[model samples]
Target: MEPVFEFPLSLDKHGPQTLARRLHQQLRAAIVEQRLAAGTPLPSTRRVAQAYGVARNTVIAAYDLLMAEGFIVTRPGAAAEVADLAQWRQMAPRTRTRTRTRTRPAPPPAIDWRKAQSSEKPIGSAATAASARGFHLGLPDHRWFAADVWRRLLLHSSSFALPDAFGYPSAAGRPLLRAAIARWVAYTRAVVCTEQDVVVTSGAQQAFDLLARVLVAPGHTKVAIEDPGYPPLRAALLAAGAQLLPAPVDEYGLIVDTLPADVRIVCVTPSHQFPTGVAMSLARRQALLDFARRTGAVIIEDDYDGEFRYGSDPLDALQTLDREARVIYVGTFSKIMFPSLRVGYVVAPPWLIGALAAAKQCADNGGNVALQEALARFILDGHLAKHTRAMRKRYASRRDALLGVVERELGEWLIAVPPSAGIHLYARYRDRRQAKRIATLAAHHAAGAQPAGDFLLDRQTTFDSGIAFGFGYIDEAEIEGSIGRFASALRGSYASAD
Candidate 1:
């Protein structure tokens, strides 16, 4: 004999509330309170109607309401069972007076987050303010992106008849996209790799995170990072329990001699250093590689915005010069394309590829298949190359305008740091103390910029005070006026300081 399903609910006959509504409310409360536990089956509608002395239609209506609200589930030839109410329990009314006196103690947290350092907001996260006439960093001009072409490709990729297209994608990545990335990097950045070497990631941030997880042995590995470097990369390494050693950078890029001898990994932006906007000299690149070879240290070369250059031919990438297979080349389409596309790739040596793919699998199961397919077509069809050429010209124009205006208006207070490539321009303050004050004042005048001190790991470290102006967000027509406003702010700051 089966157990009888009972409704421990009461209905008020004289109350203004309808009996059906009353019954529904009580049943919902019971489920929320776990009085009717998840998966508990309910009696038949006829049995419920007969036991409660209610109309059969009333019982059916209440059950229908419960089913609609997801409080219960039913199928053909099966009794209605209570649905899992874990999510619903969280949203249940807290103001309701509890009939039970016992309360369960909350479980302890899995990780002690209080001891962890908070990550800084990544560059280009200010997309909402990109349209404003200000110097926002790490943003690409989305106006030139071929959205219609991308839309068509996205639609086409979504309509594939292959069963594999709809299933969980390969953790290593779609072979077509990997091949496309391999070819694209080989031609553009001269990174030597094949499809077997590429591992697709959500973004450059995820690439750093996956690499940290695979390479860093929590609290044991010593990783040397460029001081005042990319914060997201630092956050990832720190989270993985690697002890970070801050290596100083000069005009030619990271100071290889300053790197600790015991360091197991070195993270660098050789093509174009962040915040400083200086490319690594060939001698320094070779020295760093030699250091890696001697000490068995791995190098992560982040060529984030290397595609855009203003002057003569850029130097060969560090990855191209690496002979020992110690370099892991990381690149992203975010700078060339839009940031929200969130597509990046890593070209690792044969030995590290397996570990990176496994880490990627554990991180996100792999990137979006449809997006990967669309990007592969975008690259193989020559859309990315054409777009790069067009944007490079436009960005160059804006860069020129910013340089001319800064020299003409703010020459007395700022000295521009000449950059061979990349979208942003870095300028040092004539007076170090004035960098932060001037930047704060400039923000009020709609000329937003970041103080260089914000990038340093140690705030008290003696370094040149400077500011970075990203021309990617501001248009050519707006550069002069925005810098002019910034010039006014500089004058005001100087006057107050005097």
Candidate 2:
């Protein structure tokens, strides 16, 4: 097979190396070592010749021999690539980034100059001033997804006749998948929208990006976000170069009566408010929509976790209540399926769906089509519905298990804000220092356990000001032990705080 990496042209012209034989051996070694994985495109013939100081004919002969040996596959016109590494079983994810000390001279442009670092800080932290130990507020529980099905779908999709699917995919995203999304939303979220209204996007991040691009006109627009809300939205709004006004929220959710005068976009998480798990009251939903209508502001309904509510029946999505086409609904599969899925959709007003679709097309040409199809089929075939129901039951049980533990063992240590639904709840310790320590202790027990302060900026963000740990991602057996450690950590942390 052709090598996964660029073939070294450094074989000695008159040395003991057989130019062709040496090339074949190197190719074989790379494939065997699993460095040159299957399907990786090899360097061009012209480039290979230039590298080895050999003629193009020599490289071509070597490549042909490799192909003959079933080591590589050469497309008629495209670059020669290694055969699929179907046999290579993937192991553990590289938690630590490995740095290489190379003897070769670095290239001028410096393309491969540095390797990825295993820094404790995430990109989200570096840019937003968010802490690494923040609450599980912005992201979803990735462990709940059926990733194997999607992976199989990816393999099948690549094996299809069309790689790019012959031509430009729909800017609104794949039609079959969109239809699936429409049906899935209808069944799961109880929202009303069709395939025509669904505009596939990178994720809720890009949903905001595309929506902001179309709706918000730099200085002329003002968008309202929850007072103690997602920083990413605030970051995105600021980056979008729009003015952000903090809308007040309380027990029932964002105070509709206190909205600002000139907002063109209003972002809300009616299902479960971030940080504080308050469901928006029906009165509040109507008032918010009414306020939007009166002021002509488009309500940007961030239904990020609306699918996972507890106790009460499904609440009609705010967009369903929009008669004036005022609600721009953004929903994501990241929470329900997996975050890396990066698949979200905006059911824009029918007239404006075209504009939003155009914006999406320009953003990244409608996301990964194969993934979209796989997810679409998954949802359409009822696997998503079946799996979501199963996970909800599991998460709800864990939530209860945690609440029960804290109630019995460490009741005095926290302030509870239990949700009617959603995977996480907020708890506060009177002393902020204690909160940090408890989170550290919790992490010593479990890997990703953390406090809410991590998501907050010292300047703008606000919440109960506590550590937020999740039982949703872990087992019931671990909860009691985790809580015990959490309590011990809190006491020790506070003793030091004093």
Candidate 3:
């Protein structure tokens, strides 16, 4: 039987040592150093020669030399094995010193790593995992996704016949996916753009990060974000060294008049404000556009879940309203399809697309081309729109279930902010002091409710203390039971507080 050798064997043709000599030295060292234990079999000469691209004569000569030195033993029609070296190991001279030197402690790092990680706090309590079941924020019902259809599309897109499918993908993203995104956004969100204006990204987070990398002048750029805004976006901007200014939001959305005049960038969720679920008023939308135009500041419109509105006609996206090319619109499939998909797009002005594409190239060289192609087909085939419509109905039912339960059981203590769109409901606690306590206690009762205070950018800001209940992941049937658990926790919190 052929034997196996795990030790590495190398030969340098140009070196002073001959091929056979070098192989012999390495094998000898491996056996003597105990890397090759006693009785361990060595590969056949032909196998060694083929494996290392060396001649069989060189391997045979090396084996012959080792056998002569009594380091190896060979039998008729059998591979060579390491010799018993127990006596040799005992007689070997000891080289290691008895005393050990003390190792000095490493000096502190120049950059404060703790400060860098400060922005990574979960939207809710850090004790509970963010993706925990029962009302966890920003998670879609992944069970409803059309896995079979997606798999078929993936298989088709990755066909070996298409050479471009295997090549290095475009840094700006695949043309078909970009064009699909342009058409989808234009039809659904009223976003004004063509294929040239779109840049496909891994997800909304990467889109924000790429924009931050390109636009932010480290430590000097002043960027304004909503007080209770998306934390991941905040983290991306902070990593780029932008000075974050927490702008206030009321029922109308971001208070445009209150924004600092010198701010260079404004990031807002105007379609449906995150956590609060308040759609920005048309007057306020116009006011923000005017503000951006007057201050020469760019606006990043995160139309995260704008497609699921249940009430009146949805307002035009900020990108649709922008006439001076000051808006950068970002959208994601995480809420519409599933978070793991990690597909999103950005619609920017023609001039800025180059910088964003370059930044994207530097970040990841581009997203998965095959996946992009499949997603493009998914969009073009109308599967995305169909899936979204079905999920919207499902989410709407879950939303109603959650709202009904919250109003029926916990209405006295929790006053829900009127929700016009989106899958979550934010309710301010009537007693501000007990809101955080209730949210913490609810986690122990298996209800994953997040404190509104946890999302606030400026903790000192005079916003009402509340809780956010996400309905996207929770089933309609389970909503009542989850709310019951949360209610029990609420009563316990009140009892303890009293």
Q: Quote the lDDT for 382 in model 3.
A: 93
Q: Estimate, for each residue in 1-498, the C-alpha lDDT of model 1 and write its tens digit.
A: 322345456767778988888888888888887778999898888887887778978878888899999999997999999999688787567724667678788986533444334444446565444546467788778887899999999998888745678789988788999999999998888888889999999889889989998999987999998877888888788888888888888888999998878999999998889888889999999999999999999999999999898888989988899999999999999999988889998999999999999999988887788889999999999999999999999988888888888888888888888777788888888887666677677566545567677678766777776888888878877888878877887787778878
Tens-place lDDT per residue, model 2, 1-498, is 443245343466676966787777666666755667778788887777775577888778788888887778877888888886544324213322357876777656312112211112221222221233222334444465677876777777666554567567888899988898888878776778889988888888888888877877766688888866676666666666677787767788998877777777889989887766678999999999889888888888888877776786867789887889888888898777766677888888887887888887787886677777777778877878877888888878877887787766666667767777777776667555455555666557534544555544333544456545554456677777767776776677668878
Highest lDDT: give the candidate number.
1
- Cα-based RMSD of the predictions, in order? 7.0, 11.1, 7.3
How should the candidates be ordered by lDDT, best one leading? Answer: 1, 3, 2
Q: What is the TM-score of candidate 2? A: 0.70
Which window of ten consecutive residues has the lowest lDDT sum in model 2? 110-119
Estimate TM-scores for all models: 0.81, 0.70, 0.78
How many residue pairs clash in each candidate at the backbone level? 0, 5, 0
In TM-score terms, which candidate is top?
Answer: 1
Question: What TM-score does prediction 1 earn?
Answer: 0.81
Candidate 3 per-residue C-alpha lDDT over 1-498 given as tens digits, one digit per residue, 9 for 90 to 100: 233467555688888989999999888877776878899888778888887878999999999999999999998988789999776566334522245878788998643545545553464332332355677777777677888999999998888555686678888899999999999998889887888898889889899999998999988999999988888888788878889999989889999988989999999999888777788999999999999999999999998888887767888888888899999999998888877788888999987999999999998887888899899999999999889899989988888787888898889788877677777888878888766566676566536667767778898998866878887777877888878876887777678768
Q: Least accurate stretch of 10 residues (summed lDDT) in model 3?
A: 120-129
Q: After superposing candidate 2, which stretches have Cα over 4 Å from the reference?
A: 1-148, 161-164, 430-450, 455-464, 493-498
